[model samples]
Target: MAHRDRISNLPEELLLKILSSLPAKDVAVTMVLSKRWKFLWTLVPRLEYDHSMYQDDVDGSSRFSRFVHSSLLLHEAPFLESLRLKLDHYSCAADIGVWVKTAVKRSVRELDIEINSPSLSTPVLLPWSLYSEGCKRLVTLKLSHTTLVDTSSSSPASFTSLKKLSLVHMKYPSQDLF
Candidate 1:
């Protein structure tokens, strides 16, 4: 069936439900299908931009980075309830921090960052300033598969609404995080 015919038959509620199931990036691209569906994305309440969806189990660095950029930069997502990210192995920790901070600044209730197979260097460690930027509204923060840095430069965000905090695959001295 043609694009117009198919969409014309579907109800607006159905379209919103289907778009809600997909990531913000996919929903943005769906807009090009027709003008009637252009603003359908704005009604979606949940936005999930998990980069792990691009994991090929063989090579994922380039693919994941591009996916992340597309989701964050190309979409029209507004005030997401939660931001879930799986940082690609080859990506710099600094970039991940930037993305998280952007989400928090937008009033995200839950921020989850999952890293897989991280790299280490003399000067390359988790960016501590991400938390120092003052994320008072963040309710839940989860950081996984990362190298926790010595946070001497700044302390963790006050995180007043934070109730469920989880850290996974975090490689750091016990005292560093304490």
Candidate 2:
């Protein structure tokens, strides 16, 4: 009598569905389970990057940023269903912009980004690409503790597909920008 890995024998679609329910960190860990799952996590449609989880590391912010960049670069999903980023004070504006742009290119339907920066002087500015045609497929967008720059000049049709939008502690460049 021998033990068999029944779960591993499941179809890739089923495995992917299972993997999708796990956090991005856990999903990445699955790659080491076996060769069959080495590239499977890359196909998961949802990615959530929370910087707070890496706070224990010496250079947590940098490590977290690198992790996010690597994850997005390696992601192979044709259509990303969701992208969530929970960043702390040390998160950089450039990295945030890149993450959002990448998600938009992937046709992400749901986007949730929260930045916790205690200082009012260093506000993270989202990329203008977020208002481009690439974001036409976006259905839900949530942002916090960031600045929405140059929104006044953007076309009103930019967010036509958006059904839900949530903004908290967001800064606007001008009072009439809305």
Predict model 2's lDDT versus the native.
0.83
TM-scores for every candidate against the unseen true structure? 0.68, 0.87
lDDT of 2 by residue, 1-178 (tens): 9988798999998998888787788899899988888899999998888878875457444878888899999999989999999888788777888899889889899999988774545456666657777688889999988887664553553786999999998777675643
lDDT, candidate 1, equals: 0.64
Q: After superposition, how far is residue 166 of candidate 2 from its true place, in Å?
A: 1.0
Please, what are the lDDT tens digits per residue for candidate 1 over residues 62-92? 6666666655654445565777776555666
lDDT of each model, Cα atoms only? 0.64, 0.83
The Cα error of candidate 2 at residue 50, in Å, is 0.9
Q: Could you list the CA RMSD of all candidates, in the order they appear?
A: 4.8, 2.9
